[model samples]
Each structure stands twice: as structure tokens, then as C-alpha cells.
Target: MAKGMMIVDGQRVNFDGEKNVLSVIRKAGIEMPTFCYYSDLSVYGACRMCVVEDEKTGKIDASCSMEPRDGMRISTNSARLLKHRRVILELLLASHNCNCTTCEKSGHCRLQELAQQFGVRRIRFPDTREHYEIDSSSPAVLRDPNKCILCGDCVRVCEEMQGMGILNFAYRGSNLQVMPAFDRKLAETKCVSCGQCAAVCTTGAITVKNQIGEAWRAIHDPSKRVVIQIAPAVRVAVGEAFGFPAGENVLDRLVTALKLMGVDEVYDTTFGADFTTIAESEEFLERLKNGGPFPMFTSCCPAWVKYLENENPKYLKNISTCKSPMEMVGAIFRDKYAAKDAVDGRTTYHIAIMPCTAKKMEAARPEFIHDGRPDVDLVLTTHEVIDMMQETGIQLGELELESPDLPFGLGSGAAVIYGTSGGVAEAVVRHCLPDKSKNALREISILGLRGDAPIKEASVTIGDTELKLAVVNGLANAKKLLKEIDEGKKFYHLIEVMTCQGGCVGGAGQPYGLKKSKEKRGDGLHLSDNAAMFKRAERNPVVAQMMAEYGEERCHELLHVSYTNK
Candidate 1:
């Protein structure tokens, strides 16, 4: 990554010089309408909607595909460019479905908005009127081929971002549809049910198999005790569902809203994050002492675990035996928290607010059930939870703040950082290295890996062992790194790979406004991370209380978990 200069529309700019024309334009506060040019993943020039006029060449070029030169004059919204783009849209609508009024994605669909914005009132050519069937067989999502724009956003998201080749272009040109091999149902295919596809889809082609209605039914039930554990990531993302800014930690509001919606025992998943880190650090030391696997892979991400099960089952032995923070925390409440009578032990139900749709499937996995009951009974994405809160008449801006309940309540900054990339690996090192007599001290800036990046690398020393760390938020980067590791090219002691790009901060469950910033929203989680008296996990008072209550060795049994391949 080196610095260089590039000229865009007569404005001199400093760039890595390798970015595409669209990237350069965006860097200059100029937005180019595009269908297939997603910022987090690689470019796929399937849609010609981003066509722009090049002054020097006098040619209309797709800004996403064109590379910026030293002096390239480009007009992103020129008259000729708009005309050409509109014509392209007209042709697409003629062959495709354009029933925006009746479409499920009428308000949110990118294609629908673009059509209205461009004033594409009618299809110029004779309507092809093609009909396609929707596949609703998947466990966590549904696919409607009729709504697909063939922009390859879903395919690229699944293939590149999730590292799952469960989707591909089936048939050529006019008959092309994104589907699993041989048109098999997604549930039957090697689909990990990650919902990364739904995250990028511009149309209603894909969406989560939501069970919020069931939650509402249970909430209205007089006998059922509905309890919820809010994940760390969900707190930062829920605001987006109701037009709240992205990355805004609205946990206090979220808890208040959940309670308003008739939810009992509003718990924090950070309790589980702290508990997980404690066990993970111990697991690392045990593997280091015993002659077990050399490089331990994290298994908290169900999507990543599912990807490994489908693509690289042989490497399953390397995955750390630790349940996801949300799952682990829910289990504790169901087993331990209930015994203390937080809620009626017999009927209390566990609900989880997460920044992931994959969590829906994760909760349903047979393994997640123990003692004839699933650890989590219901899973709500950030979007669904926010919707629930709004429906119950809770004012998000005015909800009185309440601190988390004890007995797996208080959380530290390390738990807060779990919502970001590399936070898991960094937290583990902070908690474990000090006990191992590592010379390195805790540092908040883990090589600038906290924010959004394709791939971030760092190194640290634990006693004599020089631990190499790589944090990948995007699955595309994970695929590249895994290829290198599979080929026996490089060695890393630990790898923290999140399913969503930028970690859960950019999760699928997030609302549209996640593209915005946190400073403007003004939440306590964001402020707590900055002003924490002790930032690390090992120093957290609550975690120390847990260790004191149950001897440190007892953590391995209470919090630790293992994964299986195939």
C-alpha cells in the first residue's frame, strides 16, 4: 500500500493510485450511481448504470470499471451519461419486472429508487413479461429470481464475502439466474445460511426468514416469560433501522425499548464476551503447553464456522472451542441465571438481539440444544428488534438509561471492542499474554485494525513465542488468506476473521443508515470505549468477580465450548 497522486475532473487528489474511478470520485465527495460496485468487495461490472462521460476520451465509461489516470476528466452526472443510463434502465425494465408499487422492496429497493429518480415512467420496447418463481425453501432466507436485477451483488457477496460458493450464475444471458448448482434448494446446497447475500441485494431477491411474528405471539402470551440477551454488535447497529445513525451505541435505549415491548431480563452479551475471552486465553495457553494444534482459529462466528464446514472441513481441528458470546451468555442465563430465579426457571425463554441473520440458523442448530431445550429460543436482527421497539411506542431518544443487571452484567471496553474487527484476537492477547509472562503491554491501537479495512496484520510476543496475527472482516480477504495458509505459505498463531466486513459494525441486520457515523448520534457505548477507566478484559471488575466467585479454572467448564466438522 503506497501513496500516489491521481487527477479526477481537474482536481488533484492523493490516492493509493490503484483505486478505480468510482473510488476516486467518492473520495472527492462525488457520488456515482452504481448497481454492482459495492465498496467492501471486488468490482463486478454487470450493471452499466454507473456510466459517466469522460471529457478527454469523449466516451461513456462505467466509473466502476475505469481506472483513474494522472489527468482524467470525468462527469458523473452529465446529460449524455444520464440519457445512456436511463436507456439502459428502460431496457432492463422491459425484460424484467418493474412492479415497484407491489414489490416487497418498494421502499428500500435500489432498483425501484433509481427507476423513479431517473423518471423511467414507461418501458420503451415491447414488454418481455418474463415470469420467474421464488424459492422459499431456505432455512434463513428466501430467493426470488423474478426480482433479481442480475447485478451479481448477491453472488459476489456469497462467493467473495462469505467464502461460500453456494450461489452462482445459472444458465447464460437472458435466462441467467443466481441459484445453487442444478437449481437445488438453498437448504440442500452447501449454503452456510450466512445471509451475506441478503445484505448486499439491491432488490427483494433475498431476505431473512424472520420469526419476529412468533416473538410477538410469545410476548402476548400470558404464561411465557420472554427474556432477551442483546449482543454487543446489535447495540451499535439497531439505530439504523429507525433512521438512527450507524455505529451509535444505543444499548440503554435498546434495553428500554425491549422492556417496553414486554421483554423480561434484558441482559448484555458482553457478559459472554468477557467469559469467552477468559476461556479462550486459557485454551490458548493449554494448547501452547500441550502438543496440540499450533495456530488456533476462532469459532465464535457461526457464518465462519459454517463456511469451514462446507469448504475446509479438514481444518476444523484448529478452530477454538468457544461458543459465540451471545450463545454462551444465553446458555448461562437459561441454566445459571434462572436457577437464581431472575425469571421463572421453568418457562423463561431466551431471545437474542444480534447484528447477524446467521444467528437465526445458529440458534436452530441441533448442537445448540442441550437438555432437550435450545440455548436461544428466538433470535432478532438489529432491524427486527428496532421494529419491535418502535411498534411498542418507546421513544428511542428519551428512554431513561439503566445499567446492566449483575451475575453476568458489567462489561469492559474489551467486550465493547468485540463489535469491531480484530477485537477478539486483541482481547484474547490482552487477557492471556500477561498471565503467560509476555513482555508486551496492552495497547488500544492494535495496528489500526479497529476500523474498516480489507485485511489488517499485527504481531506480538508471548514469552519467547512471536505471535503473528491477521484480522479479516471481509470473507473475500479470508478466502485469500486461507488459500495462502492451505498452500503452506505463511504461518499465523491466531486469525480473527469476522463474517461481516468491518466486523458486526457492518452486519446484515443493520439498517440503511449504517453508512453514517457515530459521533453525531451520541450514545454511551461509544463514549465508554473512549473514557474507560480500564479498557482491557482481564482488568474488568465483573470478570474478576466471576473468577473470584468460581475459581479461575472453573471458567473453562462454564464458558468454553468446542466445534465439530461436517
Candidate 2:
């Protein structure tokens, strides 16, 4: 591929290291529609929606599969290309279930958007595809095969990004469908419930399970004391649905919206992250003193924790016993409300607004249950919360700014960065360092801990001990690092593994966004960190007070949890 000019729709465009004609055309400012083309995944060339006419050869082929050349001339939207794209969309719509009025992904679906863009008013062909049963067996995701267009985005994302081939194409031709092996339910397979498949799905074929009805019911119940906690990543991304720019923090406006929607109390999940940071750092120190289980992997990500339980159980002991920030906070709220319940007779209905679908699964785990009730009664994704606001006829921009409830509302700067990749490692470093000065915090911030990289390594010396740390996002990258450690090719004292790329900011439950959007979200979290009054977890007076009130035994009981190999 040479750096030279090429003609795209009669305009000369320069191509330098662009892998495909689609990239070159996009670079030249053409919004070429694509269903099977994703920059982060391998080119499949299945949909043929990005086909372009080669002026010289008068032939049309998928631009996504063709390489950019020095003197290539192509027409992106010629009359013939338009016809082809329209027909392609029509054929897809013929087989797809067109019940958009009630579809979960009605407004945001790429298939619906493309069909409308191409003016597919009526499907030319009759619907001949058999209806398939919707699979809602999984706690985190739902599968509706009838809406599938065979784009294979979910299949590729699960296999390539997560290194989990739990989804794949089965059968052939008209009967073809994407599903787990032997047609098993997702919950029955070794699926970790990361929901990356749902993240990349073009239609409602795969989607995060909806809990909005249950959430609304809980809020309306007079006997229920509804409580909600918003995750750090959510504040940065939720504003995108309401016309705010990506990475803009709208926590105050969101608080107002939730309050208007009858939420009794609202808090920040970062307060829980603060507790996790302090407790995890203490656990790391204990491991260092014992001189064993060298690499203590972080356990805040339920997807990563489930991956280890499913795929590699031998190393379970190496994982930190500390519960995730969401769980820790849920447990605390449960305890606080249970005491209040004894007097007022109002049951606590705890809800978590998170950026990850796996949080749904995490909340349902038996380990987090006390007596017969789960700590977190419900888990809603960022998208779900947005839907709730919209359903309530509430406009976020119109709401007056409001603050979260006291006690669990405030969090340290270190806890705020837990939304992005390497943030957990950086927060732990901030805790381990004896120096709490501004200079120390600045140096820690620049220790290659912030980026879109899949894996980041750093070394720090704290109190006569040198610690090597690795922060890994994407389960595939984590798997690669684990293999290296197994082969004696690498070593580390602490490893922070986030299942989704770019950490929780790129979680499957977030608004559909690619690499750049995730970067913006990460930047927003760092900005929040810089604006915080307290930098370290230890400096949070509320957390310190809670620690003293709970004592060592109660803290261990609430904040720590052990995982099994199953």
C-alpha cells in the first residue's frame, strides 16, 4: 500500500497505510454504511452493503474486502450502487422480524437505521424464515434469533475480543443461525456473561436483558425504600443519550432526573470503590508479607472473575478476596437499611446503575446474598436508566442540578478513575505509596496507567519492596498475559484484569460506541479525578469512619468474598 492519491466519487483522496478502500473513502468524508465492517474486528465482507463501483473496471465489490491502491478510482454512491444497497436491505428486512415498535433496540438498531436510510419502505420478498424462540435464560443477555441478519458481529466480538467462542454460526444457508454449540442456552455454556456479543450486535438479536419494568414497580411500591447508586463510568457516558457531548459528566443532572422519577435516595458507586481500594491494598500488603501467591489479581470485575472460574480454576487462590466496589456498597446499604427497617417497617430495594451487563449477573450471585435476599435487588445498565428517564417524560437537560445523598455520595479521586483501564492499578499505587504529596500523585498519574492499550506494565518501589504491576483490559489480552506467566516468560506482583476493553467505559451495557468514544469516556474519568478534593482513599473521612465503626471482623465479612472453581 503506497501513499498516493485515489479518486472517491470524483474527489481525489490520499491514502497512507489505510488497509482497505472503505477506510480511504471514510477518510475522504464519505459516510459509507456498513453492517459487517467493524474496525476492531476482522473483515467479513458478508453484508456487501459497502460495495463500490471501480470506475476503471466498471465492477462493484465490497470496499471493505478490497485493499486501497495508489491509482484506484471508485464511485461510492452511483445509481447502480444505490440499487444494490437498497435490494440488500430489502432482502435483510424480509427475513428479519420487523416488530420495531416493541423491539428493545428500536431506536438505536443499525439495521433499522440503514433500512430507513436506503428507503426500504416495504420488503420485496415475503417472510419465509421460521420464528425462533427468544432465549432469556441468561441473567445478563437476551437472544432473539428472529431479528438476526447474519451479520456475525456478535460472533466475531465474542471470539476475537473476548477469546470466548461461546457464539458461532450453526447450520447453513436459509437455516443458518448464530448460537452456542449444540443449541445450548447461554447460561448452560461456559459463557462468562461479559455481553460483548450484545455490544456488537446490529439488531435486537442480542441485547442486554431489560429490568426497567421491575425497577419501576419497585419505585412505585409504597412499602419499598428505593435506593440507587450510579457507577463512575456511567456519569461520563449517560449524557450522550441526552444530546450532551461524549465524556461530559452530568452526575448532577442525572441525580435530579432520578429524584424526579421517585428514587428515594441516590449515591455514587465510587464511594464503594474507595472501600475496595483500601481493602485490596491491605490484602496485597498481607500477601507481600507472606511471600507467596505472587500475583494477586484484582476481583472487581465479575466477568473476569467468572472467566477464571470457568476456564482456569487452578489459580483461584491468587485472586484477591475483596468484593467488587458495587457489591461492597450494596452490602453496606443493605446493612444500613436493614437496621432502619426494624423501626420503620419499610423494605430496602437497592438498585445499581452500572456500565456493565455483568453487574446483573454479579448481583444475582449467591455469595452476595444474606438470609434469602440479594444485596443489590436490581442492576440497571446505563442505557436502561436512560430509557427510564425517557419513559418518565423527563428531559435531563431541563432538570435542575442536584447532589447525591450524604454518607455514600462522596468518593476520593483514586476511586473515580476506576472506570477506565489501568485505573485500579493506579489507585492501588496511590494507596501503597507512603508519600501522599501532590508530587507523588502526579508521578503516579503518569506511570503509563492511563491509555487505550490492552495491557500496561509498570514498576514501583514502596517501603523497601519493588512491586511489578500489570493492568490488562479485554479477556483475550488477559489470557495472553496469563499464558506468558505460565510459560515463565513474565512475572508480576499485582495484575488488574478488566474484561471489557478500556475497562468499564467500554462495557457492553454502555451506549454503542467504538474506540474513540471509549477514549473520551476514559478522559472524562481522569478529569473527574483531577477535580476531586481528596486524592487517596484513606483521605475520605466517611470511609475512615465507616471502617472504624465496622471494625476488622465486620469489614472482612462485608468487603471480602471467596470464589469457587465452578
Candidate 3:
């Protein structure tokens, strides 16, 4: 062992002034178990699963919150520590309802994995935990307190990251539980249903509502023609759910899988994003000229839309009137395809494969409903789509690749970047530029808008129009930016706000626990964009042809929708 290195289990590891022993051990390839220790959040040392012993001091402390010292000999798995962890698992298991087969997070639960890691045969502690009824009132998220491990992951994420305190510790002592104010139903509270709580949940305590059964029913129905639109982020994230690593673009395989699953028609939501870019860019240009609003906010993110509607209704008019890509595509499906395919609009079912749980709520929005049927009949998250593929025995890795159906299939590269935070603004700038200007396209590509930064701002001139653009992800960042706008400290002609961290790539419905998955997914989208034939939305032949066939005014009427302050 070296003099400056710390020894753990007879292995000398480099110490790089890591704030906690857990990080040092992890850096040395040691897997320490933890429930309450999130890398981005404040450490609370509640679980004590990572407790390590100092051989010299004869003391055990939580490795997550404990600072590492040079030449410290820490035993990560002493006999006493093993016994302590086993008992802790037993206590957690005793309180938790052991209905693993039907649980939404059965295979993915961290607590279950830890229990298996500790090799627990049975629980010694009696089941004294109080049971609570499951709350399925929210269209996007479901809450089952019986499965909660009291990790406070949901609580911290909601407050610290989102700036929305929808979930918190309620009651006192033994009766303590997580709930909205006054223990109100999640649907009744100020919950925007961003599903970050569900994303951070280690168990099925919170999860996106499963709509796979509805999709199956729609497909099985003889009268209904089931059509699906796949979102941009899903292509990158869905592969990870299977055997493939993160950021693998399996769009062609996904299309093949959908065809095998009896999906009647497959379309790309990026086609609709092309429509959005055209309409939203025109609207922004008009607003900029007429001074409709200083900063016209992008309305592609449904969760961000809901947040503005609920928390800041004053800016509702400032949001773009363009419907989200999914909804816009649904409108096109219902209006054009029904007559073309000789099927009644009532019998045609539209399903959206999205990377967001909030899209479920957005699909169910009253504004999107017409003739007593929703524009999108069902919303399947990336997780649910993977489950569907597995259930149907479709081998995604081995399947022969297939292209999406025509008309709404080929999307421009501008549409491809919509999955990340700064992507929307960059896409808009690209669309605004003329196709012959290769210099403008190159400039747009490197315009310092795309990154993991919470907020990014850039000023660029496209086609004689000097545009001020701001791109923001995470509602907390959006809130701060909005405050700056209110104070007149920040000024912009256009702003793109995504509710999640890295836009749709970091969506709540993505697969859990993939390191740097969002960045990889974003990179995948960029790679896909580089390979694409069309770079600008204005140059997309299908969208341009559609606009020519059906006048832009009529297309706006059909594809665009309104917002409400509910």
C-alpha cells in the first residue's frame, strides 16, 4: 500500500480529496449500498447502508457523509457492518408490502436489489407499518405509500430541483408520511405532474401510470386502426431498457418492433416537430415584429405548459399557440389519414410513444379532446413501449430494421435536436435561416446553446433579423429566468423552456439508473441530426407540401391548439 493512499479491504486506493468516503470507495470500484445518498442532492445519512468501520479508531460511520482521510484503513464489509445492513434490510422489508410480481418497479427497485445483495432469507421484524390506499387520481403519476421506504428522494427533488413543493413529509413520528399539503390528493394539489418524484423514487411508491393495457385493447379492437407516433427521445432511451447500452439510436428497429406488435401505422413525432418549427418560428417572428410579448415562450414541453398554467398564468398568452409534436401529429392523423385510409375518425386510435409521463396528462387535456374522444387515445412512455416489445417477443437487437410510414415519417435535422434543452432554440434559428446559407447552418450548429447547463443564452442574426434567444431546462431554472425577465434584467425575443433537466432526454418516463444517460441520449440525437438529409424545417419537403395542399391558415387551425389556466 502507498503512504498517501487509503486502504479498503486490503486494496490500496487513491484518495483525491473526495468529500465523502462513499465517493472514494466508489471511485476505487467498490459498490456501496445507499437509499438516501443521491450524487446531486444533499446527503442526509438516513439509510446508513454505507456504514464503514475505521480499524484504528474502532468506530463505524456513514461513508456517504463522512470525509475521507489519508492513510485511513476503512473496512467496508466487516462482520458487524454486514449484520447492521442485514437488519436494516429486514426492517425495510417488514414494513414494505412484498407484492413484487405485479409492482410497477418490480425488476428495477433499488431496495429489492439491496435485499438480494445482502442475501436476506426472511424478515425477523413483524409487519407493523400502516397501509394506505393507492392514489391514481393524477393522469400522469400514481402514488402508493405502502411501497415507500421514506428515502425522501421525492421530497428533495421536488423542492430543490423543480422548485415545486408538491410532496413533503406529513404527520409526526410513527405516522409520518409523504403527501401534499393537508394530505390532499396529488391530483388536487399544485402538482404539475412533471413525474420527477416518480423518476427519483427507488420503489413503486411513485410511478407513471401504465397504459399498455389500453394500447393492447385499441390494437385488438376490430373497428379501430391503431397508429403510433414515436418521439425523438424514445429512440435513444428505449434501447437501454433492452440489452443495448444508452444512446444507441434504434429508430429503425423500433419501427420494426411496432409493425410486429400489430401497430397499423408508424409515424415520427419529429414530423410534427417540423410542423411546430414552421408555425412556432412564424409566430415568434410575428410577435417580435408586433411586440406581442418580449420573450415568446416555447410550448413543446407539456409539463412546462402545465407549470405556467398553474403557477404563472400571466405568461399564458406569451406561450406559443402551437400544440406539442405528439398532439400536432395526432391532429394530422385524425384529419388527413381518416379519409385517406377509408376509416372513420372515430374508429382510428392514435397512440403516442413519448419520453414523458406528463404527456399522458397532456393527451387527456380537455383542449385536445373533440367529439368526446381525445386527440391521442393513449400515451405510452418509453418504459411502457419497451415492455410492450418484450411482451410480444420482439427481439429489438436482431430484428431487421424498417423505416417509418410515409408522409409523416421523414423529418428535418432541425426536428431531431428537439430532445435536448437548447435544441428547440437552435432548431428555430436554423428554420429561420435560408437553405442556401451554409454559413448560417454551420453557425447554428455551433451556437453554444446545446449543453447540460441549466440555462443557456445566445444572440445570433439570421436572415437580417438579430434574435435574442434563451434556452432553459428544469422548472426551477425557468422560474429564475422568468423572475429576471420580470425585473427587466434579462431580455430576449424567444425562449425555450424544458421541464426536465436535459429536455426530453432526461424525462421522467426514461429508464432508471443509467449513468449520464441524458447526455448520451442528447448526443445520439445530434448524431442522428448529422446523418439526416434535411437540415432545416423550412426545407422539409413533406411539411412544405402539406402546407401547400392545405393552406397555412387551415393547417394552423387543425394542428395548433390553445392553453388553459387549470
lDDT of each: 0.74, 0.93, 0.88
For candidate 3, the per-residue lDDT at 482 reads: 94
Determine which window of 10 residues in candidate 2 has minimal summed lDDT.
115-124
| Residue range 270-309, candidate 3, lDDT tens digits | 9999999999989887886786776899999998999988
TM-scores for all candidates: the values are: 0.86, 0.99, 0.96
Candidate ordering by TM-score (highest first):
2, 3, 1
RMSD of each: 4.0, 0.8, 2.2
* Candidate 2 regions with alpha-carbon error over 4 angstroms: none
- In the range 452-535, model 2's lDDT, one tens digit per residue, is 898899899998988899999998999999999999999999999999989999999999888899999999999999999898
State which candidate, 1 or 2, has the greater TM-score.
Answer: 2
Q: Give lDDT: candidate 3, residue 148.
A: 92
Candidate 2 backbone collisions, by pair = none
lDDT of 1 at 147: 76
lDDT score, candidate 3, position 283: 89
Task: Name the TM-score of candidate 2.
Answer: 0.99
